[model samples]
Target: MDKNIKIADSMLDLIGNIPLVRLNRIGKETGAEILVKPEFLNPSGSIKDRIAKMMIEDAEKSGVLKEGITIVEGTTGNTGTALAFVSAVKGYRFVAYTPKMVSNKSRMSIMLAYGAESEAIDIQDYNKKMGLDADDDSSVHGGHVELLPRQICLDLERQHDDIWWARQFSNPWNVGAHHDWTAKEILEQTDGKIDAFVASVGTGGTILGVARALKAHNPDIMIVGIEPAGKAMMGAPDEYPLIPGISDGIIPQIFNSKIVDRVISIHDSDAIDMAHQLTQKEGIFCGISSGANVLASTMIAKELGQGKRIVTVLPDSRDRYLEVEKYTT
Candidate 1:
């Protein structure tokens, strides 16, 4: 109530400036110091808030998004929730299409809570409706199980003047947000001494964007990308992720191979195990993709040895996984 007190005009103002915290117990055995950006601290409880705000504001500047238009996007969950959060604040209607029975129900619920429409697209159901066999390869073209939802957004955008698909996978602003804000904050926090940067590849925006900045600051910084076991996100021809955190090997357009030095796959079990370790040992309380990133970071930390510093991101909060029992089980 003090006149001098500072306050945010909107939740949008709290979306960035997420602080980096050092891991004390979990990665101590690795000898190298592991620092994690607690991106879940963002307003919507995930790093996607950064891109959601960026994409919407950029669209406003470019006149693609205007009053009375409904925003549409295909997401696993985080991006949809983030966009819903932003749209609710900015007075736009939001519609998120996610793969049916795949995304965490908690996240979809959060989107709906923000007054957004959350639709689950059942691929096999659509295939059957379209006169294709349930097992047809074309049903999930590009080897991505989530393609059906994206196609729905595309169709809606093409068919309606009031519909604008955010297209986070290919959107330049998705990369721009991290490159301009997330990476800058990391550099400022770490003083540009990062020896390695690691993150789970969802849409591939975070790792690629941060890698660009970290590489420019210090070309020696190793950029490591994490993939769910069997998913070849870094240039391999045919493989897909098992966990919902990683994408379905449909390499996002925002991802660039030039900045990435390595792609490591972590099993779902290993990721879940590490998530528990992060919660119990380090008090991180992150989701499975965060587990994948930290596990891979620990691997790199050991390889880098003592005195090396590695940075990664806890992409979302454990609350999203609470009902799914991904961490509880």
Candidate 2:
């Protein structure tokens, strides 16, 4: 055998260690020290990469997945793209079920680019088929599609076949991954000095994990959850023009409302406008949800008084939402 040793053999090696950048000019405006966890720096340009890797690795360890298996999950954007990236690297075929409102061209391009497959489901169609009222409980209606994948995957498991279903919304592994990695990184980067943590509620994993970690270090720290106003999904009031980076109507089962100190609801137009401002003024090309979170954080900073340290996540990069921006403009 050769004496030479090799290390860091895969792209997965690049999953974490995202950068932490202090927002200088923005902080000056609010008079609160502001830091942004640039999750877009990840290999897949989103925070979901952390959980995507964890979900896949955990499934493999539990023998729920094996070689040549297919992976499936439900996502609107970032999570699906991250899953596709992971599946491509790990030699597993991947598929995603997204809402019909998601742009087909964008989803297909990203999926194909990462060498994965995807299918967009019409939520209205599923609702009608299941005879669910428009305002009926979402959890009950959410399961209609679950059975489709569960039945197939369960049968494969029974036959000792390899198949993985990454139910991100309900997977404890999803929350655990952030608890272990993302939250830890934030604490380390801030040297345990984070006074306030703000994040938009999607799967709730990010906020739950980060909030728990921050509060453990200092109970005085405030944890704020931001959601889109008027049709917000995470137990918040719902509104129209359902924008990206807000709740998707399905509340994540893992989200812990008690841990959140305050919840701010942002308007879709404001989020879009702020996203534009971020690009124009801050030179940070981020998604609309980042804008929503930033808007919420700024408001919180103003409300809480000056000289506070606030950290938030810039969830995904702007490249994914070019279509939305273009269409709106």
Candidate 3:
């Protein structure tokens, strides 16, 4: 046997450990050495793969999921696609739902390619479809974001006994995955030299989990949380953010405001422009959130000065945003 030649038994084996590429062009301009964790290389195409595998395997061990069970969750795109891919490999059915507004057909198509089902429901129709009484007033999880997908998950859980809800937003495994794998990989890849960290917030799993780990390793590692400029999740306005993956209406149960040293909000136009700039300047084909991360990283870098290694995550590829003209065009 060739000792250097090994093989992965399944796609699940390729969840974590992505490349950390230094930003040459952008870093030079900002006078800060920015490095990116290209999470798009994950088998499912985003950092969601890490938590997806962690959540599913943990559920399997705890008997919360089994052969006859159907996995379900509400996701804008990434997490749903991750679950869809994992469920397919584990021989289970998966159903995902997203608010019609945030829904991306490209991501849903990828999920369908993996043998998963998807639904895009109108936010205005949520009250009726979910069978809620006018007297029963229940707000969505994130303040202004669509609540249909979450309601769908709850409804399915109530209607079917053999259903496993991969609640990535509140699941401890979601945080644990990044704490155990993502953060460690970052630390190892950067050789414990990361002076700053930046990432866009969605379910808060990535920032919370990774921040805790990095802080524990070195309390001085500045952890900055990035959000869509208009959409504020922590101590800010709940206006709808233009970006899809971060700064949604509701704050995630897993997200902790205290762990983040500070939060920076980026405007949609600027974020989209920076994302385009990243691809053109650094040859990094990243999504909207990743661009947001770069925008935040550069801001921090300019403040911190040179010789400091600032790290951030490139959440996924540009596949999901190809339809948005301003984001792509």
Candidate 4:
């Protein structure tokens, strides 16, 4: 964050340099020191803010993005929100394509809140757009939707001449943001005492990027990856991912498997249960993926109990996922 720059100049200025807080309640039983990087404090309310800034600004520097071009991408989650936030403050037009799920409506609302247009691209229709035969099991693969999002970017960019496709999943700037700002902050915040690093694989940008940066500082530092159970990339069954924006059926182009020392799978029940517990005991109201990271951290803490330090990333807060309870008789 550029402190000398006026906040009103651009909210993008307040994107990175978040805080790291010690987990008192969750880590207490495990004995190992557990710390969480509270990325929810970011201006866009998620860690995606870091990548959004870097990607768009990098495009500007490279002359790929201009004043009139529309920034198009596929997401209904934190990445969409961050891009909408950045475009809102930075004088760029943004359009996002998401599956027409009822749950996606809320995320669309958030993008609309920031003046970004949210279009519902029918999943089947987008599959056709990607030249895939929906009926073919080899093509759709019992709902093989891993590439649908990015495919939307590819389609829109080809059709529309003025679209600046922010290919977040494969974008180098995505990794660069975490490597330059996020990893450096962690090193500085922890005074270079980080024993292990843990995070979930979404675009695999965060974990891979931060892992490389941490290892660059100390090769002895342990790197761990958490994925929802059943993600194909991690050699599991292809069940639906409980945490949205965590993973799909395919491995992202930007992810580096070699950067991870350990990869663990978590269940939806365990993640949600831990999320509730975190809210009640630790007072950390984080997103579901954050809970998964916490659950992973707790396991690591238990294994290396006492005297070791473990750090993980809490991707976002709970604001976007909060639901109104249905009243009962």
> What overall lDDT goes with each candidate model?
0.83, 0.74, 0.82, 0.80
Candidate 4: list runs displaced more than 4 Å: 1-8, 125-143, 236-240, 324-329
Give the range where candidate 2 is weakest over 10 consecutive residues by summed lDDT: 134-143
Highest lDDT model number: 1
- Clash counts per candidate, in order, are 0, 5, 6, 0
Local accuracy of candidate 1 as per-residue lDDT tens digits, 131-181: 867664321212455678888999999999999999988899889998999
lDDT of 2: 0.74
Over 1-329, each residue of candidate 3 has an lDDT whose tens digit, in order, gives 11233697777877776768998898587677999999998988989999999999999999989999999898767888899888988999998877665557788789899999877766655555556553322222243434657777888888989988888878999999999999999998888898999988888889999999999999999999977655467655544466767745577788889999978888768878888999999998888888889988999999999688899999999877898788867
Sort order, TM-score high to low: 1, 3, 4, 2
lDDT, candidate 3, residue 144?
41
Candidate 1 local accuracy as lDDT?
0.83
Off by over 4 Å in 2: 1-7, 101-104, 122-124, 132-160, 232-238, 325-328
Please state the error at residue 64 of candidate 1 in Å.
1.2
Q: Please identify model 3 stretches exceeding 4 Å from their true place.
A: 1-5, 127-145, 236-240
| Clashing residue pairs for model 4 | none
Error of 4 at 60 (Å): 0.1
